[model samples]
Target: MKKTEKIITNKIKINDRFWGRYLEVVRNHVIPYQWDALNDCLPDASPSHAIENFRIAAGESSDDYYGMVFQDSDLAKWLEAVSYSLENEPNPELEKIADEVIALFGRAQGEDGYLNTYYMVKEPNNRWTNIRDNHELYCAGHLIEAAVAYYQATGKKQFLDIMCKYADYIDSVFGPEEDKLKGYPGHQEIELALVKLYDVTGKEKYLDLSKYFIDERGKQPHYFDIEKKKRNDTKPFWFNDDYAYHQAHKSVREQKEAVGHAVRATYMYTAMTDLAVKTKDESLKKACEELWNNVTQKQMYITGGIGSMEFGEAFSFNYDLPNDLSYTETCASIALVFWANRMLQLDANNKYADVMELALYNGTISGMDLDGKKFFYVNPLEVQPEACEKRKDKKHVKSVRQKWFGCACCPPNLARLIASIGHYIYSQKEKEVFVHLYMGNETTVQIANNNVKLTQQTNYPWDGNVSMIVTPEREESFTVAFRIPGWAKGTVMKLNGEIIDHIPLIKNGYVYINRKWQENDHIELSFPMVVERIQSNPQVRHNVGKVALQRGPVVYCLEQVDNGENLHGLILPRNAELKANYNPDLLEGVVSITGDAERIDQTNWNDSLYRPVEDKTTSVQMKAIPYYAWCNRESGEMIVWVNEKR
Candidate 1:
């Protein structure tokens, strides 16, 4: 089995106008603010006390354990983000702080290598007793990931050694062995983290354990059911015994559709893809492909958001996406990106990179505000402040970003993703270098026993032009593959000021340029940027007669601050001349889409419940901002799909 190579985060330097600002925010603002939140230092925000739980479990603090069962994972994720941020740009103070946190982990871990502050401080006697509800393995998975990332960033093995001990302990407790308990994580994260641990330490046991967890899930006499019987508890299951909620209804290979909690489903799929690549498991690879198709085609939002309903924070049936009541959790989309990257590694196909870019530019970043302090847990396509406040169904939706939430998973997730954005841009396999995303950055890749330095300059998502400068250490033969986005058309490429008119070289959504003897080669690509109106399939009942605006990779939305009240009443004419204008003064310099539309004049309705069919309308100019930038300025209603006038 041939495995794909990943570029270390420290090797790539991002300097784009768009992502560069986000990276700065993650380093300067989000990381520090989250550090404070973890310590319970934010006076105006909800208490995190995640750090305190570790202290209390370590006998360094007297406070009782507080917060959710999965609170410890919050610190784990934050530390992971800190690892990436430090790799991108070194900071001594932040490194010191992260070092202190690692020392805390050392003290909190038990003699038998058991960790998890919630169980240590509160439920020591009941450790691993309730893997069905509690996120014990989930927290361990995140801590292991942070440990791997920190070790990769700083070459420090303190945290890595700690997690290795905990992982070894876990391996002893659960497996196919007769004495070990036959249980897996209800949350489906450790499987992927184990793959990372294996990658770092070359420990075959970690790889085998990850495969064991994936293979054991949803088997006969399900583990959750067995555990429930062992505990001998009469209480009903929290999710009403719907095994699908935990994605345990059927074996992984037999399961066709994407189901269960959105984050868990995506995370598990990511790990499955990883194992498939590492072990050459054909059936597992096929299952991943089917699930990937179902997710990106039938059940995904236009903004690359998944998990349609808030009931279980899970995916509904096909084409059941409702904009206003959608629970497109930020973490789910980030996890989708994770899964997409793994799929790309499995095969350098454009299909995976397209969705990865979609989520990165729209759904994922929409979870955080421009300033990086406020965050959104549920990213609704359409929001009304009054409906969010008054309606029962829309209660999960928020019209504005909050300081912090009690659950507090999405914020740190976003921070780490943005901090590690460089990892998604490029991938390599042997002599082939694949450019998955067109971000402005520079990196060096060893191809054919020669060092190749590649630099990219682009104002992507706002402009469609990209320029690349490739410099190899000596005359070497290699291939450079650049992704031609699915949304782009009439793409023109130039090699050293000469047009490459051959179209046969483009395959699988990428244009391949193979040659030898390069010292200062230059490549230019142009993809004409235009405002386009997109319509959903008729099966999507909510968006049947509506159209969404998109320019480049950025999806646009209508906010009441720009459109006015009753955004639903606005109708965009099919023939309206949509124009894209770069507004440097608005929404942190975004390309806003403006067009002509009609509004239903309800001024003289006089409180009538029903009125005669009158086509009384007024001409109005509508302005749509990038979906990610909405709610950053004003508090009002926002809608992505507007009524279309046929």
Candidate 2:
């Protein structure tokens, strides 16, 4: 029997409350508030404005052409969201709205090939001439992803045909063949987008093109610079972006640390992982491993944030994790999830999932406000609102989420991530289906030419009693791999309501259960949610005197608004009794900590920098919320890691 045929996969069906949160945010907040704010920020006199941009530089224009990048990505994200919702609720209103949004996008794509507004509207005579900077390829990448997602969601081919034309057009433009001009996307997303195109159409060309881009990238005789010379590369693609980080000195894997444009680096790494998985290339896989180690071990924040410096908005140094002035972009964290999840597929490692979970819980989710209209570009851990203003060099580190942004990356980026998250749940090779994330959702996927229904039932990240029911097409023995989270201390697995004994729960950081599953076989996993105090590695000097809290996947932090007075003065006194409570009335829905943080008072009004008055202890109530939800409430002080009260 085929592997997928042997095991039945069941899933936990996600209702509106589960899957609709981010989508609802997109519909209610993103469209009306942020998108317009972004459009308003763009220069009206510029050639790239809404009316005259990439797609129709030589022909008649459509509103759909102008909204291609945002519209296509938004449609793709909405399609995913609505499909998940329809699986459970099947709302006509949402379906109608989603259909309309996709309909306009479907109409905008040209017949022979081409879908960009700037070209169609502004300079019809100069479409391909400005491929380097005009976002022609970037637009194609978004449309390709949109086509795949929309096709999967509704079995609609209207937009898919359009993207096929666009992809074929782009594929024709760049390749490994001589005289083909070995050009790659300077922004680095079309590679991953091409993978999505291949997945839907099963066309070897799309996959081949994606691989060519990955192989051609970072090679000597740099394609970007070569293309620059051809176009007279006047200002460079992103005129402001100096091509310092896109090219590589050695091999792609030899590149040790993250460099150059923050978004470009992350997007390239994401595509590399996609290519690695598709081709099963060990060298590419090895490169991904080295890069992951560099990010998590050294260039990562305690709150799972990345990009310590704002200069290029890229990673600067290892252990250079600054709190008050950190440009940990919300989009970068989203990209980290993208990279980490891809790494998870290339191998079965707890560490990959660990970083993914960290980014999702803290860095990624921190992008949006509770109401969803506002968004944070940078998620800094500690905020000295007073100290923040004096820093000239750290201007990119905005402590609060803004209504909209000029670059406008994080909002739509977060939307797409939350929408396509089902892909991160499980992975299957032949016989074994590996369960990765624990969410209350049900999913049906084909493996080994057999249908597997995976139904999960649990309120994860809050409580860890996860029960999975898997059903196979035919009874065949296969190894079912369940992830044992790195944080899981007392892990237990049960089969058919009976506890299984003598099976290893931890192996290379994964628990494997081999069994011949029937039509309905229930597997229960208990991941004990223990309150763990997280301290930085000894190498992190600044975090030595402080400790953060974590129960399950959430990293907790204390803000001055809730604690009152000095946030630095607060601490947990000498192994104080720890308590956790779910405060529904707090910021959205969050777990709040109210178990005594000792306060200190210093009355050295005359001191300048060091010398202070006697340290006097003052016991006070300190409440801690999820680090992601902290800054949305007030403009006061906030701290992620706090002084330990001894």
TM-score of each: 0.99, 0.87
State the C-alpha lDDT per candidate: 0.93, 0.69
The positional error of residue 646 in candidate 2, measured at the CA in angstroms, is 5.3
lDDT of 2 by residue, 1-646 (tens): 1111121222434532333465566555554443344244424321223323322333344444444333333334334444443433456676675566445544555665766655655455665664444566665676676567656656668768767878897777778777576766655677888987887788989989988876776677766667667756556445245454553434576677776656667777888888788777888888888888888898899677888777767776778787777888887898888888788778878888888888888888788886777788888888877676778765665666776554556766776666566666777767767777787677776656767677888867777889888887877577778888889887888889888762555565777787777778999989898778888887777788788888888899888788886688787875776778876677766678777667776554456666545667777777888888878777788888888855
RMSD for all candidates, in order, please. Answer: 1.1, 4.3
User: Alpha-carbon error at 259 in model 2, in Å?
Assistant: 2.0
Off by over 4 Å in 2: 1-12, 15-112, 123-134, 233-244, 247-250, 445-452, 472-476, 502-505, 604-613
Tens digit of per-residue lDDT, candidate 1, span 309-367: 99999999999999999999999999999999999978888999999999999999999
Worst 10 residues of 1 by lDDT: 1-10
Clashes of each: 0, 37
In candidate 2 the C-alpha lDDT for residue 406 amounts to 44
User: Residue pairs in steric clash, candidate 1?
Assistant: none
Task: Give the local distance difference test score of model 2.
Answer: 0.69
